[model samples]
Target: MPNWVDGHPAESLSIKDRGLAYGDGLFETIAVRAGRPPLLEYHMARLAEGCQRLGIPLDLQLMRTELLAFSAGLGEGVAKLMITRGEGLRGYAPPPVALPRRILQSSPFPVYPQVNGVEGVQLFPCVTRLAEQPLLAGLKHLNRLEQVLARNEWQGSEFAEGLMRDQSGRVIEGVFSNLFIVHEGALITADLSRCGVAGVMRAALLDSARAQGLKVEVRDIPFEDFLQADEVFLCNSLFGVWPVRSVTGHHWPVGPLTRKLQAIARDLLDI
Candidate 1:
């Protein structure tokens, strides 16, 4: 239940921290269960890629040890690890000597209806479009205004998740989770090379789906295709997977493939 900033217990960040000033940081939301993080490698892989692209140095081994300790402390919860470029002066340019700051915090696992994963959930199509920034695509950086605004568009339990698209109306992903649709017995998900966070759960599912000999395709999904999908599901590290029952008026049954993958997720995530 302790929050650590650079290995020290700190509740507040420096006002000049680059993460606050310009959203110059990367974050990973890790699900800790039974004193361990199951999908940690996938999260670390993405974080490492993000740090490399942003020119931030990451000692993967060190971070792994820290995260394990953090997870053990919390026992069961979500661990958020934020790595920033540390404090900076007023400017757009990064400092020559990058003093990266690591902030680790934990929160209780979210409470949701048990039927969410069993039956399925309704999705609200959001109007807030994700900009096509190839440079920022697939990275879980600190900048999340797009998701914030999209999530703010709806309220209450009518929709458990919201579907977001690119400005061109290409179905991208969920406000938080990645989108996957079963089409003609194939598992299809958005191509995140242009925009959207390449979630750890998405990556893991892709591998698992392929290992099970399921057809998997990552490509641009049109709104019509998404609506016509045999079965739809949303996934993230925390929730594992949630089938989408409807979007607008279009409806889908919790299909065979969705259930198959849900079992895989439960095994992999131990949720």
Candidate 2:
């Protein structure tokens, strides 16, 4: 169960819980190891930036303490830390003095068979297109109806994920993870400024690739490019990385670069 303080499980959210009523909140799905969530700096930076964008006041020290107390002794698993504008007026107007709500919950880590990434996975070309909202784009906020619909559009085992496009018909990303396509031995992924989640793992890969002397292209991806790409992979914080074996009738290989990146990611995550 999730609640606003450490160890106290409240029955219901405060009537003014902005996230439930207005989706006025942000969240992070972090990987916890030894009961401690790693990459705290990156997550905190996102939180601080999210608060600035949403006009919410953020107390980083307080949040740090709460997170530490909440995840204490949980061993290893996934943790979702959320912050919402507490109680507020009935309308969209925020309260003058907002009481922020902090909610934390833990779950068993999603186990991935080592072979899953080593070999490859499948994908479905989702019919749903991500509606671009420049102001709210890439924040990982609570308004996730687009992802919900895209995910619900698929019910096949052949593909473990759905690749989504934007309203402009440009490929954006996978439903939850980031999309990367290899072309001519180069790394390419969607530029997520207009839409899509800015995944933490995807960021790590970008930085790691640059460090390893690989050029990463961030640009608009068209549908036709997938048919010509050498390889594809979907990445997220929890799953780390997964190579795409096929999409629709198009097939791809788990290339050397994909495997090398996966190995680097696995070592980084210590999985």
Best by TM-score: 1
State residue 174's C-alpha deviation in candidate 1, in Å.
Answer: 0.6
Off by over 4 Å in 2: 1-11, 113-115
lDDT of 2 by residue, 87-188 (tens): 788899999998778777777888776666877888888989999888988888999998899999878566788989999888888998998999998999
Q: Write down the RMSD of candidate 2 (Cα, Å).
A: 1.9
User: Model 1: which ten-residue window has the lowest total lDDT?
Assistant: 56-65
Clashing pairs in 1: none
Kindly list the per-residue Cα lDDT of model 1 for residues 226-268, writing each as its tens digit.
Answer: 8888999999998889999988888999999998989888998
Model 2's number of clashes is: 0
* lDDT minimum window of 10 residues, candidate 2: 1-10
Model 2 steric clash pairs: none
Number of the top candidate by lDDT? 1
Candidate 2 lDDT for residue 26: 91
